[model samples]
Target: MAINFRKGIDSSLDGVTKLVFGAAWDRKAAKQSGFARKLALKSGGKINLGGGQKDIDLDLALILYRDGEPKRIVIGHNMDPVHGAAVHSGDNQTGEGDGDDETITLNLTSLPAWVTEWAVAVFAYKLGTNFDQAQNVSLNVYDASNQGSAVLLDELMPTLGAGATASIIASGKINRDATGNPIDGWTTTLVDKAGRLGSQGDDTAVLAFAKQNAGI
Candidate 1:
């Protein structure tokens, strides 16, 4: 599929069963002060915020909703499996590598029937970290079941710069039709909003965004 994401536009997930969602970035070298380092440590101590390079850490999560109400969040911080191992998160604290820094896998068939909508979100987790401090930041979706011939289903690349100060972003959403059949019931929409809803740190923002998006 020639997947192109436009804000607020939805793409079909016709025959896709399992998917891999990837978030990637490369950190830029920068000077960190003592206070900054302390702050980074205070916020979970997930990375070393030294003076050499600014540790740009990005997080990927899924906010699940049932009947337009936020129910659960599948996050990487604690590595908890949701919906009977239907969704799993791969957390990366450092943007040290080439490709995707963090990933989340979703098995649509394993999801519970109550799950009506799911929101895809990524955010800058480390203190003082923003999209501007990273290079080649992007979120990608791939057909995981098609291992040998995996196809790129969709992608969302956040623009980096001055306006990229937003710590969190609502990347996209996967909504299912309760009354329809499995394959034709699910639809994925690209939200691509950077902190436009809220940025209250530990996912309060993403939760609120999901609820609002669901009109609840």
Candidate 2:
């Protein structure tokens, strides 16, 4: 869908912040940092998997906001995440068709008094085979505040073919939507490499919309 930001509210907040939370695939002795802990705590703690093919599952959460005010937003849980609004409890292994994902939202006008920044967390799990050495995963934030849904911030894609498990966290700004209208929010796009593992990879690209952007 196209988001036009020509009409709507824009954020006067400062520049965006990006944080990558995950262990390096080669860091075997690395310990869990505060980023990982925060995700676990925010997502009710612990990572759960379902039954299906053995594949790596990545858990992600994006916190949106304006001039420090938190905005209500959701991510893809199953296919669409934003529109699907799929909320499944517990994690699933085996890479089953069932989707085990999480969503996040902030009250744009009522952000936490102590929160000075926004955060995006992600967890990457290797199910059957490891990721391709030439492939990289990226997290994209779209300006869902308008009609065009433009991309506000995108993290540098990660290379997950190092033969290790890990997670990552990054921060971004809530820019105007695709049409240039500023609704004070944004969405997420999870990008994977070529193929996943066994099955032709499917190389799914999930797009999540911000609830506050629906009006635009």
Per-prediction TM-score: 0.72, 0.32
> What C-alpha lDDT does candidate 1 achieve relative to the native structure?
0.64
Candidate 1 ranges with C-alpha deviation above 4 Å = 2-4, 31-52, 83-86, 147-149, 160-183, 196-201, 213-216
Worst 10 residues of 2 by lDDT: 205-214
The lDDT of each candidate is 0.64, 0.34
Maximum-TM-score candidate: 1
lDDT of 1 by residue, 119-206 (tens): 7666665456666677777877888766685567766776544535332333333444656334344567666555443553555765
**Which candidate ranks first by lDDT, i.e. highest?**
1
Candidate 2 at residue 34, lDDT?
68
